[model samples]
Target chain A: MLELHQISKHYQPGGQLIEALKPISLTIKAGEYLAITGTSGSGKSTLMNILGLLDLPSRGDYLLDGVAISSMNDQQLSQIRSEKIGFVFQSFHLLNHKTALENVMLPQTFGTVPLSDIRQRATHLLQQVGLAERIQHKPAELSGGQRQRVAIARALMNQPKVLLADEPTGNLDSQTTLEVMALLEALNQQGQTLILVTHEPEIARRARRCLVLRDGEVVSDHLQRCTDPTQF
Target chain B: MTAQAKFYYLHNHLRSCLNELRSHALRSMLTTLGIVIAVAGVISIVAITEGMNHSLVKNFSQLGTETMMVRQNIFKAMNNDVLQPMTEREWFALQNLQTGISAVAAFSRVELPGTGVSGVRISYAGRSQIGRLLATSANLPQMTGRYPIDGRYFADSDSDARRRVCLVSEELAATLNLQLGANKPLLQIGNFQLQVIGIMPGGNRDILGTSADVYLPLGFAMQLNPKDIALEFGFRSLDESNTEHIKRQVNQLLRQIQGTRPNETANFVIENATELKQFQTDTLGTIRTVLLLVIAISLIVGCIGIMNVMLASVSERTREIGLLRAIGASQSYIQSLVLTEAAILTTVGALAGILLGLGIATIIAAGIPQIEQVILPPAAVVLTVCCAILVGIACGALPARKAALLSPITALNLE
Candidate 1:
C-alpha cells in the first residue's frame, strides 16, 4: 500500500520556478496493477520518481506501508527503497560490466540477505522470466527483451513488495514489449504490486487501474476488469 | 566493522584493483615508476649520510679517546711561527698545574736517509719528509692510547738514559721495507742512532695519503736535534671535564713561558675534542639537509607522477564506480578502493627501493678502502618505507575524493 498527500515538486529552471508535480493526492492498495500515464513534460515521470522514493517531494508526506518517509535521511530512504521497492527502467539499466546473474544479485548486496540465498533467488527469478540460459550474458550481449527480463530479476533480488516499472517497454520492439508485458502480468499474478509508468495507451491498457495526468495534476482515474485482481 | 571484516574488505578491494592494473600492465608499470624514483632518492640520501657519519666516527675514535690539544692561543695556526716551544720550565709549571692535566708531548717533523734501499735514487732528498714525529716522556703512550704493534715503545729507563730508540708507523715500516726482526739499527739522523723498536698502527692518512712517522724519547730528541724547531704541542687529560679550564691555564702558562705581551697574538692553536665533534656533526648535518632536500624534490616528482596516473585510472573506471554506487556502494567505499590501490603501489615500490638501496650501499661500502663494514640500520629502512607510503596516501587523496563524489545517475549514463 502507498499514499501521497498534497505532493508537489518544484524546480528552478533558468532562475524561474517550474512546478514538476503540482499539489496532488493518490493511493493504491496491495497487489494492485496501476499505471500513471501522461504526455511529455506532464509530470508523470516526476510522480513516478516520487513514488519510487528516488526524489523528494517539495511539499508532501509519503506513507509507504504506514511509515512516513518524508523526513527520513538519505541512508534510511535507501534502506526502505532496498527493502520495500524495486525499480525497472526503460533503458534496462543493467550494469554493463556484470553478467545477467551478477546484475540480478546487485540489489542483494545492499540488504542483509545471505549471498548464497540471493544467488539462488536470482537464478530462480531469471528462470521464471525465461532467461535461465542467458544468465551469464552481459546486457550488451542480450536482446532488449532479455535485458529487461534481467532488470526485472534484479528488481526482485531483495523480495521487495512493490515493483516499479518506468517505461519498461520504451526501448523494445512491439513483440519484445508484449513479452515483457506478459512477464509483468505474471509477476502481478504472484501477488507483487506493480506500478507501471508509461506514455503509450497500449501499455496503460494492460493495467487494472489507470491514472492519467495533464500538466502536474491527476486528471482521471479508471479501473478495468481483468481475469483476476490477484492475477494482475 | 570488525578488524577482520575490514581487512577482508581491503583485501578484496586491493585484489580487484591489482587485477585491473595487471590487465593494463604498461599503465601500471608507468604508475609505479614515480614511486620507485622517489624511494630511491630517499634511500640514496640516507646511505650517503650514513657513510659520512661512519667516516667521522672512525676518524674521531682514532684521535685518542680523552685527548685535548693545548697550545699558546685559541686563534693561532697549528704550525706555530711566532711562539717559542714549550721548554723545561713551562713543562715543570704544567706538572704542578691543577685541572686534570695528564701528560704533555712535543711534536716535530724531520727527514732521514732511506734505510736498506741501496742504489735506489730518492726524490726530494734535501727536503724534510714532513712526518709527524713526537718527542715525549715515557707517559706519552699512556696519554695517547698508542700501543706498539711489534717490538716495544720507549721505557722510563730509556728516557732517563737518553737512548735514541725510535717507533715507526706501520705504513712507514712498509715503505722502508724494514722487517720487525731485522738486525739493522734505525737510520742515523743528527747525533742519534735511532734503533727501530716498534711500529704503530696506521691511522687517518694525511692529504698526501701518508701515515704518521716515528717517535723518540724527549731527552734524546732535544739533545740530538735542537735546531729542527717547528713544534706543535699536545696535552692529554685524565677526563674530558675541565679540558676548557686546563686549556686556558695552559695558554696562560705558555704566554708566561714565551714572555709575550698580554694582548699579543700567540702563534699556536688550542683545539678540544668537543669542538672537533661539533664540527663533524655540523658538517654531517649540512650534508644531510642538502641530501634530504634533493630527496624531497624527487618525491614530489614521484607524487606528481602518481597523481597523473591515478587521474587517468579514475577516468578509466568512471563507469565502474557508477555501477558500484548504483548497487549501494557508499562514497567511502569508492574512496577506500582508490586509496588502497595507491598504498599497494607505494608499498611494493618502497620494498624494491630498500633492497636496491641496500645493494648499492653494500657495493659502494665494499669497494671503499677506509670502510671496514657496511651497516644498513633498520631504522633508516623503516623511515624510507614509511616516507614512501605516506607519499602514496597523500598523492591518492584528491583523486580518491573525486572518484567518490561522482554522481551515480550521471555515471551510470556515461558510456
Candidate 2:
C-alpha cells in the first residue's frame, strides 16, 4: 500500500523555476495493476521516480505502509528501495561488464544475503523470466527482448513488493511486446503489485487501471479491460 | 552483518576493483608511474645514506668511542690575546688528573714546506722518497686508541730519553722495501737517523693530520721548533661513559692553566669520538631530510596524477555509480569503492618501486667500495609504504566525493 499527499516537484535550471509536477494527491492499494500515460511534457516519469524512491518530491508527505518517507534519511530510503521497490528501465540499464546472472544478483549485494543464496535466487528468477538458457550471457550478447527479460528478472531479485516499470516494451518488437505484456499479466494474476509508465495507448490498456496526465497534472483515472490473449 | 558476510562484502569489492583496473591496464600503469618513481627515489636515497652512516660508524669505532682529542681553536687563537701555548707542565698536569683519564699524549705538527704544502724528504739504504712526517708522544698509540699493525709502539722512556725511534705507515714501508726484523731498519730524516719501531695501518688522511707516513718522538720534535708550534693533546678516558665528564674537567683545568675567567670562552676546542659521530649523524640527518623533502614533492605530484585519473574515472563511471546507488548502495559505499581502487593502484606502484629502488641501491653500492654493505633500513621501507597509501587516500578524496554526491535520477538519465 502507498499514499501521496499534495506531492509536487520543481526544478531550477539557469535561475528559472520550472514546475515539473504540480501538487496532486493519489493512492494505490496492494496488488493493483496500474499504468500512467502522458504526453512528452507530462510528469509520468517524474511520478514514477518519486514512487520508486529514486527521487524526492520537493513538497510531499509520502506514506508507505503508514510510514512517513519524509522522516527517513538517505540510508533508510535506500534500504527501503532495495527491499520494497524494484525498477525496470526503458534502456534495461544492465551492467555491460556483468553477465545476466550477475546483473540479477546486483540488488542483493547491498544486503546481508549470503552469496550462495543470492546466486541461487538470481538463477531461479532468471528461469522464471524464461531466461534460464541465457543467464551467463551479457546484455550486449542478448537480443533486445532477452535483455529486457533479464532486467525484469533483476528487478524481481529482492522479491520487492511493488514493481515499477518505465516503458518496459519501448525498445522491443511487437511480438516481443506481446510476450512481455503476457508476463506482466501473469504476474498481476499472482497478486503482484505492478505500476507501469508508458505513452502507448495499447500498452496502457493492458493494465487493469490507467491514469492519464496532462501538463504535470492527472486528468483522468479509469479501469480498462485487457482483450489480449496470454500466449507467452 | 555477520563477520563472514562483512568479509564477503570486502572481498567482493576488492575483486571488483581489481577487475576494473585490469580492464584498463595501460591507464593504470601510466597513472602509477609517478608513485613508482617517487617511492624508488626515496628508497635509493635512504639506502645510500644508511650505507654512508654505516661506514662512518665503523671509522669512529676504530678510533674508539671513549677517545678524546684536544686541538687549539685557530680562530680563537688568532683573535684572542689570552691564548697561551701548552707547555710540558700543562702536559704533566693533564697526566696527573684524577678524572678517569687513562692515558694522555701531546703532539704537534708543522707543514715541512710551511702552510698548505706537505711532505718531507727521507732516505733509506740507497733509495730516497718524499712522505708526510709527524711528531708524537711515545704513548700516542694508546692515547689515540689505534694500535700499530706490525710492530710495538714506542715507550714513554723513549720519549722521555729523546730516543731516535719512529713509526712508518704500511704504504711508506712498502714503497721503501722495509721489513720489521731482529735488526730494526734505520731511515734518515733531515739530520737524524731513526729506527723503525712500528708499522701503522695505511689509510686516507684524517682531519687531524695524524695518519702520517712517518712519526718521530715528541721530545725530539719539540727540540726542532720549541717556540713556534703549539702542542695538541689526546686523552683516552677509562671508558665511553667517562669521556664527557673527563672532557669538562679537562676544559676547566686548561682554562685554569691559562688564568682565563670561568665566563670567558676557551681558546682551545675539545673533541671526542662520540661528538664526532654525533656531528656526522646530524649532518647526515639534515641531508636525509632535504632528500626526503624533494622525494615528497615528487610523491605529491604523483598523487596528483592519480587524482586526475580518478576524476576522469568518476565522470566515465557516473552511470554505474547511479545504478549502484539506485540499487541500495549508500553514498559512503561509492566513496569507499573509488578510494579502494586508488589505494590498490598505489600499493602496486609502491611494491614495484621497492624492487626497483633496491636494484638501484645495489648497483650504486657495488660501484663504491667504501659502502660495500648497503642494507635497506627497515624503518625507511615502512615509512615509504605508509606514505604512499596515505597519499593515495588523500588523492582519491575529491573524486570519490564527486562520485558519491551525484543524484541517482540525473545519473540514470544519462545515455
Q: RMSD in Å for candidate 1, one decimal?
A: 10.7
Interface RMSD, in order shown: 4.3, 1.8
lDDT of 2 at A154: 86
Candidate 2 per-residue lDDT, tens place, B199-296, comes to 99864244444667788777776777677557788877786766667788998898888887877767678888778678768988999899899988
Every prediction: chain A TM-score: 0.94, 0.94
Residue A196's C-alpha lDDT in candidate 2?
Answer: 93
Spell out the clash pairs found in candidate 2.
none
- Give residue A151's lDDT in candidate 1 (0 to 100): 90
Cα displacement (Å) at residue B269, model 2? 18
TM-score of 1: 0.61
Clashing pairs in 1: none
